[model samples]
Target: MPAITPEQRVLDNLRDTLQAYVAGDVAATAVVTVFRGQAPALALPEAFQRVLDELLRRLEMADVFSQDSCSFSSTGIQEQLGVWLDKAEARVSARTA
Candidate 1:
């Protein structure tokens, strides 16, 4: 089996962090920190970064409201994060391949 790349590791961590945040085991800031801290390691495209930033922004707003206010559903954001993960993994794999 091919060894996991650093980008893959970062992506996995982000997914796990998002899950933990939804579970209330982690703070919203911590989740944002994980994304910001590890983003460089992923070497993501600018498009991905922009999308992530938008998601993080929505996440912060969601946290502030602490409910499905302003149409910012934490659950919806989490689902978006999952989709982001899928696309990021594909992008990373394509690059490596």
Candidate 2:
């Protein structure tokens, strides 16, 4: 077997962190949905954007937020920012796991 790369190690950690939720050889679709629902509508920093995009990509959704996307929201702006903070923390946990 080939040695694991750093990126693979990171993904392994992510899979492991959410592994409990993926019982009986399942994917984490429901969990991803929960996380995405909590993610906010904001113009993410590049690093944050990539994490959110990957989270969405894994979740099979297309709701990546950028400046253009952020512009479309009209209400509850502060709530959105708060959710982004939650998402950022979630992103950290997902990676560091």
Candidate 3:
């Protein structure tokens, strides 16, 4: 079995958390909250962080703010997630090279 790198672990966690959020899992908020709590230490560039912050805010708004009032659509969330993942993968590739 191959050992997972910290970067891969983080990415995997993010992917799983995003999937949970999209699926309306009850624990999504807590997971995202914890992830955001550790975001500062991730050493992400300001631009990347800004985009990610927006994505997080959208996810929170969809999941928490409208939980009782309206149904949350995962379309926008998935798009933002794709963007973030692409960028993160690029950064990982650069770092590994």
> lDDT of all the models against the reference?
0.87, 0.44, 0.68
Clashing pairs in 3: none
Q: Evaluated with TM-score, which candidate comes out highest?
A: 1
> Which model, 1 or 3, shows the larger lDDT?
1
Off by over 4 Å in 2: 1-27, 41-46, 59-87, 90-97
Question: What C-alpha lDDT does candidate 3 achieve relative to the native structure?
Answer: 0.68
- The weakest ten consecutive residues by lDDT in model 1 span 66-75
For each candidate in turn, the TM-score is 0.90, 0.29, 0.71
Query: In candidate 2, residue 18 scores what lDDT?
Result: 49
Residue runs of model 1 more than 4 Å from their true location after superposition: none
| Cα lDDT for residue 41, candidate 1 | 80
Q: What would the TM-score be for candidate 1 when compared with the true structure? A: 0.90
TM-score rank order: 1, 3, 2
lDDT of 2 at 58: 36
RMSD of every candidate to native, in Å, equals 1.2, 13.0, 3.2
Q: Give the alpha carbon lDDT tens digit for every residue of 1-97 in model 3.
A: 7676777777777777767766767364665685586555456789878887877666677666654343444466666776787778678758866
- Residue ranges of candidate 3 with Cα displaced over 4 Å: 1-3, 67-74
lDDT of 1 by residue, 1-97 (tens): 9898888888889889988988989998898899888876888889999999999899889889975776799889888988988898898899999
lDDT of 2 at 9: 52
Q: Write the per-residue lDDT of candidate 2 for residues 1-97, one digit (tens) a residue.
A: 8676454454444444344343424334544554454333332357766665564453333223431254433123323433544665566556646
